[model samples]
Target: MNARDPQLPLQPDEASQIGAFAQAMWDEHIVPELTHYIAIPAKSPMFDADWEKNGHIDTVLRRAAQWVEQQKVAGLTLEVIRAPGRTPVIFFEIPATKAGSTDTVLLYGHLDKQPEFSGWRSDLGPWTPKYEDGKLYGRGGADDGYAVYAALTAILALDRQGIPRPRCVGLIETCEESGSFDLPLYIEQLGKRLGNVSLVVCLDSGAGDYDRLWLTTSLRGNVTGTLKVEVLTEGIHSGDNSGVAPSSFRIMRQLLDRLEDAKSGHLLPTDFHCEIPPERVVQAQTTADILGEEVYKRMPWACGGDGGPVLPVTTDPLQVLLNRTWRPTLSVTGVDGMPSISNAGNVLRPFTAFKLSLRLPPLVDGNEAALKLKALLEDNAPYNARVSFVPDGRAGAYGATGWNTPDIAPWLSGALESASQTHFGTPVGYIGQGGTIPLMGMLQKGFPKAQMMVCGVLGPKSNAHGPNEFLHVPYGKRLTAAVAQVIAAHP
Candidate 1:
């Protein structure tokens, strides 16, 4: 898309008015709908194995579609598209006011949520929405059920102000939390419907802070699976096996040692590593200067809480950002074959099993990394004991290469700055997200010429996919206005 100097559509007074309208929309419409939405246990397909049979997915999709239709924006169309054995896609569209304008803006989000994790405060539950201190606590609201509402509100705000905007499409899928397994099918079937697009806006990312708008320029993909090691046929008395055989847990540690340094938390494999782009490094330094202590303070560090006090690996904010977004890391998410402490006895476990999760840099191929990891961990087992590395899933990484930056970057930057200063009293910030949204990579590949923007309200301590996940109400409103500004300035 060619860049043109699009004048600021909203003056100071007009921006104030739009901000108020956006806030009102959130308080009166978005929050109420979100409360109802949070009540549905609409877990993703991975978590809810019987999602289709339980009918929760269908129920929530219908509810969301009904609400969007009720908005009744002029020239708006909403469709619920379904393919065999795949989750539904809610396709929403608004025609551009300028006749014959073919420029399309694709806005993306998801309704399916991560499983209801444990450890919520006594009063907060995953399915129960709570509003307090300007924060709405729930599972899917921020991580993002508010996406469809926010996207449409932006266009609606522009239309209300009589600002010319490009044709807009809002695509909300139901399988994102499960790694977007079904999105490709819908994209294939609806390719024609999504014509040549000027820009793609994804509202399913992270924000470094609430004081300003944060844009995600990169995302680390992941490979997940189980690693198992067996040394003995059955559990034996510790007294008998203590000196006779190697502990299975020890064997498991040896296997993992081949992949990562236990003390330094560094991935040992060279293929899993990548060089961080210079632009991203500069962005990280600028962001660090803007947020020094807040970088780690914003986390849910235990002030003697139940999770216990924890320290960041490093005090330097720049390194923290780089380590999270531009580096490879490994985590042990779950384990099996170990008895509970209460039921445990003095015995040598027959086998040790662990769920392995690895985060690869944006430039690494998840499939290739997984293959290398399997070889590194499963081969040459200590004592020739039985070992297995079964990779259950892999999603490749994504990077917003310099070429993805459209000519309209300056205009979009101005819009973000205006919106942030008007509502947040701070300048906008740019940062990369540490988590994965595999769809970004897919879209980037399919529309290599399209400009992309990634922004979301999953800010500090929002705890998406964890206990007490929440959406900041005020930030949500301001974000809606920011989106409106971008749409209004698109040329």
Candidate 2:
């Protein structure tokens, strides 16, 4: 086989070969690497404060780098770049096989894992690897320790078949699960070394289903922080302080009322919301039609008193999709100054604190929202309590802004369509993800003309950041081939 012209689309036989190559690569190498990667608890910097001392992040980074180097792709140069007090990044570059091509395809993923959430099945654990029924069950494997492996495999598959491709670069970071706080610094340092980035392949977003290729069009911004309300200097007997001193929990609830409507679950502040673009609305409607009841039913709802599944906020598929993707929502992820039921006592706690995670619309400014959120929760405290809302991250980088993808170019759109049809036998699906990817927004600002192919294997019930998280191995194999096809078709 000879290297084909970069201008021509991949033929059916060529696509088949690419698919087979990807499958073989996954079976022979990638899956085993991910299995070992899953066993290491390389939690993100925020989750593991002692990441520098613990060295788990470095272990994963070094392993991935070693694996990439072992591949020995022609004209490849790899580096594990690091700075003081920051997580490391694996930066690798492959010169273009196509003559006179200057554009770069920046492939992005992360090796960091989320904290160990509860509720895994008996046989599955966050750090315990299990492969069952074509699903790699464990933390980080799907959300997305397999990204670097899949990315390199795609490149190798193309090279193996003598297919010409443009310059490709990989930026696999170790701080994404912590909102990618360290990425901006590295991106700035890499500046011109990143080349004229024309396409970004971010394999960190989600898929609505495992049937076909799904493109993420928009992502919600996030503002996380701790909101604490101190009503008393010290704990007191509940019997003595019931009427005299106000309960910190009660004051905390009152303060939260300023931000959210408890009954409707709506964010009371209008600044956090943004108008849903018409195109995105149309895409959401299409996705809703395809997904139907599964849009809401996919949630692991608890059983109701009547022995039926608990109802979601809404059953209308379009509304459910929009509510999650284009609306502002608040989640109190953790609480402090509360004792377990087994350790409960008749003493009023001195303070009440909550770890707040606020998701804003794609167009909203996360830092601005964070500032407003701080003022809203801390002002006019109930019973003159000492209340504060401290936003997460450093002073200037308190929140993570969301991303709205630019209009897809004709060549890229056709490539995506052809790749999806070739791999999954369906046209590409477009959907907006409710989760935030901080790097997407940063890249958009850095490379305004770049086409964002933000897709991933996080399909229905893959439960990332929660218990029993697994990577759909079959979907992953197809996705890898599909990615190679798209890259081959890149103009």
Candidate 3:
């Protein structure tokens, strides 16, 4: 009878406090803030070598810190600590009472955005945050910029209710779009200071679509390399070499073709085998039923290309999720060595290269995968033309044994469920997000004892990182309340 209840059911006033706070803030306060934020193209130095000189990065950090400081959450203070050459990380903390009574939750997010790639519809650029059809569209909005607001919105909402809270620390990273190159150093620098975190909530990624809130159980490791095909020592005029030049680009495609099955989009090499675990298979099936045809339709594809529904995003949500979270998959992210249109010439380029990004499953030894991939690509090169691989980057994938999950999941599930009943229509569905957040791996290593929750407002069609990327304004506003409900009911 003396045991504390597993959940602290919210009083009506408490529930109102949560919802009203988010709704009010988002409608008037949050959107404007995100609008101004999305306008700053603070590309990561990892992606833009001259980011500092561009000055947009500094502007972004300052604006984010300023917006956070304005939140008036009692006892909450924001700090920006930066090592000499490294990017800045924003830290904010609402100190808790009775030190050990409520656990400390370390909240993480990022402020940087990806470079704007081509293919944006006119007026739908990365810097333009547009509102249309129940969504906020912009580059940084979903990928991570929204997390800054989402984290603070949740933290502030709980405080507005006067509920005693876990010591929530907001860890805002700057290089997330670029593989978190500076995270380890930040973690090391913050060393003992980041000690005693009880739970980690990474607000970077989100559910597959918009029906549910997802938990990331694992992230696929990544190996990025450039495959270069050198067909000849010198360029030859297309008129003279039309038949004999042997296009380097053509050769590159042929090599790539051998790596994957053209029909089903499956990787052919046995070197990248990963089976969807049975439990996850069940998760996928459940998700498939919930998602139905909408899942495939949500994907952005070329015009007249499967414009209608095709196969369920993955017949297995778990398998689909696994391919994203755990398995190794080859994606040719970029191609180079071809001349541009403005300088069009009828000459065969001497060389061509394709940038490849390979996702590695859990326990697939990152180094081993890199080596295996290098060998595979080299061997697959067609016509014995000179070929070489340029190592871009490599990192290990991460998987946390959800051991403490069983203990903490009830609180998370219930909190979100309660909020969903009020805001979303149903209980928050548990799902997985595919994408590499290296800091999650570092945090998992740094705080093995801390149970983590990774939730956010980014949806599938949000098109983060690509052109026309945007955040769903009202949805994010409501998510703040959802986070608050969970925190208030944390047992």
Identify the candidate with maximal TM-score.
Answer: 2
In model 1, which range of ten residues has the least summed lDDT?
A: 397-406
Give every collision pair in model 3.
Answer: 136-471, 137-470, 138-469, 138-470, 284-317, 284-318, 326-361
Give the alpha-carbon lDDT of every model: 0.83, 0.92, 0.71
Superposed model 3: Cα runs more than 4 Å off = 1-8, 98-102, 209-212, 239-246, 302-326, 340-345, 362-368, 378-386, 394-408
Model 1 alpha-carbon drift over 4 Å, by segment: 1-8, 303-309, 394-408
* Residue 42 lDDT (model 3): 88
375-431: candidate 1 lDDT, tens digit per residue: 888888999999998876434421111112333367677877777787788988888
Ranking by TM-score: 2, 1, 3
Global Cα lDDT for candidate 2: 0.92
**What would the per-residue lDDT of candidate 2 be over residues 1-491, giving only the tens digit for each residue?**
24576666677888999999999998899899999999999999888899999999999999999999999999899999999999999999999887778899999999999999999999899999999999999999999999999999899989988888889999999988888888899999999999999999999888999999999999999999999999878889999779899999999888888889999899988999989999999999999999999998988999999999999888899999999899999999999999998998999899989999999999999889989999998888888899989888877778989889999999889989989999999999999999999999999999999999999999999999999999999999999998998788777
Please give the distance, in angstroms, between residue 220's alpha carbon in candidate 1 and its true position after superposition: 1.2
Error of 1 at 176 (Å): 1.1
Q: Candidate order by lDDT, highest to lowest?
A: 2, 1, 3
Using all chains and alpha carbons, the TM-scores for the candidates as numbered come to 0.92, 0.99, 0.87
